[model samples]
Target: MSDPIYEQVRGNPKFAQLVKRRGRLALLLSAIVLVSYYAFMMVVAFAPQILAVPLTEGGSLTVGAPIGAAIIIISWLLTGVYSHFANGPFEQLNNGIVRETLK
Candidate 1:
C-alpha cells in the first residue's frame, strides 16, 4: 500500500510550487550555461583570431584564456546561487510542507 504521508505531500500546493520553482531555476541556469558555452564555441569556430589575440601588447597570454576562465568562474557562481536557494528557501519550504502535511 502507498504511504498516506507521501500522498499528502504529493497533494500539497506548496510541494507543487516548490517543484515548479526549483525546476524553473534549474532550467534557467542550464540555459545560461549552454548559451555561454555554445557562444564561446561558435566564436572559436568562426573567429579564432579574436580569441588568439594577445591580452597585452607582446604578452604571452591569449584573450581566449581569460574568456575561458571567466566561463568557468560564471558556472561556479551559478552553482553557488542554486545551492544557496536550494539550502535556504527550498529547504524551508519543503520542511514547512512536510510539517503541514503531517499535521
Candidate 2:
C-alpha cells in the first residue's frame, strides 16, 4: 500500500532542498578528493623526482610520504565536514519534514 506520510514528505519543497544541498555537498567533496588524488598520481607518474626528494640532507623519508599522509588526512576531514552538516543541518531539516508530514 502507498503511504501518505511518505508521499507528503516526498512532495515537500524542503525535502527537495535537503536533497539538493546534500547532493551538492557530496559532489563538491568528491571532486576535491578526486582532484587531489589524481593530481598526486599525475605528479608521481610524470615527476617522480619531485616526490623522491628527501626532507633532510640524509633523511630516509621522502616528500611523497607527507603528501600522501596529507591527502588521507584531508579526505578524513572532508568526511567529518560532511558528517557535521548531515547530522546538524540535514538532520534538523529531515526531522522537520517528518514532523510536518506527520502533522
Candidate 3:
C-alpha cells in the first residue's frame, strides 16, 4: 500500500502493544454494531410501518400507520450508533495506529 502514515510506523513495539490491547475490544464492538444493524434492517424491512408513526393525544394513531413505528424509530437510532462504532472507530484506530507507529 502507498500509505505514508503506515510507512511511517513500519516497526514499533508500542504500536503493536496498543493494537494487542484494543484490537479485540474494537473488533467485538464492531461486530456487535454490525449485528444490531442487520437486525434492525431486518425488522424495518419486514415491518416498515413499525417505524413511521404520528403522535396522537386523544385517540390511537391509526392514520394508516402500523402503529409500531415507535419501535422502528428506536431501532433506527441504533443505526447511527452502529455506524459510529464500526466506521468511525475503525478510521480513528487506523489513524492512531499509524501515528503511534511512526512516532
Candidate 4:
C-alpha cells in the first residue's frame, strides 16, 4: 500500500531543498577527496623524487611524510566539517520538514 505521509514529504518543497543541499555538499566533498587522492597518486607514480626530498637541509623527515600526514588530517577535518553541518542545521531542517509533513 502507498503511504500518504511518504507522498506528502516527497511532494514538499523543503524535502527537495534538503535533498539538493545535501547532495551538493556530498558531491563537493567527494570531488575534493577524489582530486586530492588521485593527485597524490599521480605524483607518487610520476614524480617519486618530489616526495623523497628532505623537508629541511638537515632534517631526517622526507617531504612525503608531512604531506601524507597533512592529507590524512585534512580528510579527517573535512569529515568533521560535514558531520557538524549535517548534525546541526541540516538535521534541524530535516526534522522540521518531517514534522510538518506529518502534520
Candidate 5:
C-alpha cells in the first residue's frame, strides 16, 4: 500500500485540489519571498530612518527612527522563513510529488 497521505492525495478530490492549489501557492510564496529581499534593499536605501539613532552608550543604532532594527530583524526572519522552504521539506515534497506524477 502507498503512504496514506499520498493515497489520500491521489484519491481524494478535495485533497488533490488542495495540494494543487497550495503547491502552486507555495511556489508563488517562495517567489514573493525572493522578490521581497530585493525590495528590502530599496526600502532600506530610500528610508534613512532605519539606522538613525543617538550615538549613546545605551542606545542602539536603530533607535529614535521610523524604521527600527526590529523591521530588519523581521526581514531576516522572513528571509530565513523563505529559505526554510527553498531548502527544506516543502521543496522535498514538491519534488516527490512531481516525480510521482511524472511516473
Candidate 6:
C-alpha cells in the first residue's frame, strides 16, 4: 500500500480507537497473567511448604495442585476475554476500516 493510503487509514478516528482499545485490553490481560504467574512463583520460591499442605485431613491432594490448576484456568479465561473482544467489536471495527480504506 502507498504511504498516503496507509496514512489515511491511520488518520481514521475508528482506527485510532481500535488501536487504543486493543492495546489496553492486551496490556491488562498481560499484566494479570504476569502478576499471577510471578506471585505463584514467589510463593513457590519462598514457601514451598505451604504448597505441600494437603487439601484434606487424609486426602493426597496438595494445595499446590489446585492453585496451579487455577493459574492455568485463569490463562484460558484471559484468552477467552481477549477472543470475546476480538470476535465482536474489534472485528467489526477492523472490517469497517478495511472496507473504508479499500474504497
Candidate 6 per-residue lDDT, tens place, 1-103, comes to 5699889899999999999999999999999999999999999999999999999999999999999999999999999999999999999999999999999
Clash count, candidate 4: 0
lDDT of 2 by residue, 22-89 (tens): 99999999999999999999999999999999999999999999999999999999999999999999
lDDT of all predictions: 0.96, 0.97, 0.59, 0.89, 0.60, 0.96
Worst 10 residues of 1 by lDDT: 94-103
Give a tens-digit lDDT track for model 4, residues 1-74: 88998888888898898899888998998888888888998999999999999988988899999888888888
Check candidate 1 and list the clashing pairs. none
What is candidate 1's CA lDDT for residue 16? 96
Better of 2 and 4 by TM-score: 2
Weakest 10 consecutive residues of candidate 6 by summed lDDT:
1-10
Give all TM-scores, in the order shown: 0.94, 0.94, 0.35, 0.93, 0.39, 0.91
Q: Which stretches of candidate 1 lie over 4 Å from their true place?
A: none
Which is the winner by lDDT between candidate 1 and candidate 4?
A: 1
**Considering lDDT, which of the candidate structures 3 and 5 is the better prediction for this target?**
5
- Total backbone collisions, model 3: 3
lDDT of 3 by residue, 1-103 (tens): 5787555655555556556646666576567666756766786789667554444656566533442454455556655665665466656766676666656
Better structure of 1 and 4 per TM-score:
1
Rank by lDDT (best first): 2, 6, 1, 4, 5, 3
Candidate 6 local lDDT, residue 61 = 99
Name the better of 2 and 4 by lDDT: 2
Q: RMSD of model 4, in Å?
A: 1.1
RMSD, each candidate, Å? 1.1, 1.2, 7.0, 1.1, 8.4, 1.5
Model 6 residue 98 distance off true place after TM-score fit, in angstroms: 1.8
